[model samples]
Target: EKRAFLAQSPQLYKQICALAFEKVFMIVPVFRAEKFDQPTHLNELRQMDIEQAFASDEEVMNALEECLAYILKEVREKCEEELEVLGQRIEIPRLPLRRIPYSKAIEMLREKGEEIEYGEDFSKSQERLLWKIVKEEAFFITQWPEELKAFYAMPYEDNPKLVKAFDLIYRGLEISSGTQRIHDPELLIKRIKEKGLDPKNFEFYIDCFRYGSVEHAGWSIGLERLTMAITGRKNIREVCLFPRDRKRIFP
Candidate 1:
């Protein structure tokens, strides 16, 4: 019997390479089996995944900010004509996009008349409202509850209940999400068990931390989502030449 899965993201592979490379990046096709037929989702997509060793989530966030600014500048100069066709314009985001803690964001939403509670993930409409409240095209939401994040996310030293994870929200959508990963093998196994997952099933990945795994952080960006944000496309299918979703599979 074959034991495998269609890689949903290149997260594990990039982290494995970071063990020796220190810094690594990849853009690859990722597969998902979601049943959603939304305008912004597809069964197959492309993702840009990055991993870096001996880095904190804060350091990686700064690097990501610069990377996004550069991308916006390049698109403005190189794709002006194309953008015009799509009736869109790229607004170069400012450096160090605002950072709002998960708790504060919830408070802001409540003040603005949203009934969201702490530890709850934001829905699509809620994300839109949060973006409007901040009035920034790009911003970050950090300090998510540990239970809300994956077991690999590192917990805050001062607040073990919260993880050192973040989400990059752009124009009412989440373009990326990342965190400082747990590098201690024992802690990693503990977290896996806490999440009700069998650590034995992930023996290979867990073993990578047994010897000398270094502290690392990383994030994944969606190419389709970026395209949608830049071109002001309401639907992801508009930008994708051949989007594969629940209904369509062949060109």
Candidate 2:
């Protein structure tokens, strides 16, 4: 190992934390080295990474909903001017949001003359297609097949084809992705292998299961993306105080 990538967010760390503490949340900086350009695509961003053990995916979504609701309640009560500018005024969204599977979303898009391949994730345009119908939604679509999700998503029952996963899409953009995780050490290793990655890098993570771990799940909500949405900003850079992009860096 010459050089290694260090996580800015406590994603992997929190998973370990959940081993001892079943429910934990962290609002931290996450450094992503990919080239950035879109208003929402910054090289470095603030991420609210959370994972809960001994909980189901639905429970995790409910928790995230509660957190977002509390934030909005505070903002509306205090940040009147800001909310006025954004033209957003709201309280808690309903209990359950609209949950559509990737396969169904694809079919709907195809009806709109968009031929999509199975197992492929949605592109911006594809998302917008659904957004038009779900514009006023705070709900989520779940059960993206394992192939379309990260290795961490737990496989769904009766549907070994799909994973127990979901994305919180609001105002047409993905705000959060939460799902149950593979607690079985063997399954985690199998997932890692299926993704064509070595298991060595994740040895430390795998160690959690080797010891004793609980069955918990959690979701992460991108902070910058939330800012852009809440502020009604078209470009993501507008939300960040000092946004760092691919071509723009200085203040």
**Highest TM-score against the true fold, candidate:** 1
Q: Can you give the lDDT of residue 215 in candidate 1?
A: 90
Error of 1 at 211 (Å): 1.0
Report lDDT per candidate. Answer: 0.91, 0.79
**Against the true structure, what is each candidate's TM-score?**
0.96, 0.92
lDDT of 2 by residue, 166-212 (tens): 98876677888878888889989999999999999999999888887
The sequence of per-residue lDDT tens digits that candidate 1 reaches over residues 1-251 is 98889898877778889998999988999999999878778899999889999999999999888888898999999988998998887888888899999999999999989988788999878888999999998999999999999999999999999999999998898888999999999998999999999999888898888878999999988889988988888999988988999999998
- Stretch of 10 with least lDDT, candidate 1: 7-16
lDDT of model 2 at position 145? 74
lDDT for model 2 = 0.79
Candidate 1, superposed: residue stretches over 4 Å from native? none
Which candidate leads the pack in lDDT?
1
